[model samples]
Target: MSESTTPLVWLVIRKDDNGNRYRIGSYATKAEAQQIADRLDDRGPKQLYWVERAGQGGAQ
Candidate 1:
């Protein structure tokens, strides 16, 4: 298990009924991410994906 001392928040927002669904979040693992997804109201055909960090770069 990949455990991070720092906690993160997961978010899913849709622009409208006709518009596409947008998945946004900050999470340490997929287990935590799935928890957040289960709490949402399903009203569309869109899916959710994770957003990864792109920093600390090749420099590290």
Candidate 2:
């Protein structure tokens, strides 16, 4: 498939204590994004990590 046609449907987002959100990375699969988010979440509790659809509202 072409790069433009391949959808990056998964987004890994991080939110800090100040309530600011950032898009850490994008992945073609939810499982891949979730694994990265889970690993980051485990490293510390100061920040929060989660996965959502790319255009849903979590992150862009």
Candidate 3:
């Protein structure tokens, strides 16, 4: 598929106290992913949330 037609996914990542990181969710847009991250971040400081763009090959 062409670049323009290739599906892009924005990931909301969470890092825990033990330094373990994983994907919280995948969104079609960065704004959506950021929203989720921001909401989760406001819960507390124990865990950190951030948004990242998935690689073209679907890897983080």
Off by over 4 Å in 2: 2-5
Whole-model alpha-carbon lDDT for candidate 3 = 0.79
Clashing pairs in 3: none
RMSD of each: 7.9, 2.9, 5.3
TM-score of 2: 0.81
- Against the true structure, candidate 3 reaches a TM-score of 0.74
lDDT per model vs. reference: 0.45, 0.87, 0.79
Q: Write the per-residue lDDT of candidate 2 for residues 1-60, one digit (tens) a residue.
A: 887787888999998888889999988889999999989988966688899996699532
Model 1: lDDT equals 0.45
Q: Please, what are the lDDT tens digits per residue for candidate 3 over residues 2-55? A: 767756589888878887888898887899889888999888666878888886
Ranking by lDDT: 2, 3, 1
Off by over 4 Å in 3: 1-8, 56-60
Worst 10 residues of 1 by lDDT: 51-60
Q: Candidate 1 regions off by >4 Å?
A: 1-16, 42-60
How many clashes in candidate 3? 0
Give the 10-residue window scoring lowest on summed lDDT in candidate 2.
51-60
Better of 1 and 3 by lDDT: 3
Cα error of candidate 1 at position 23, Å: 2.4
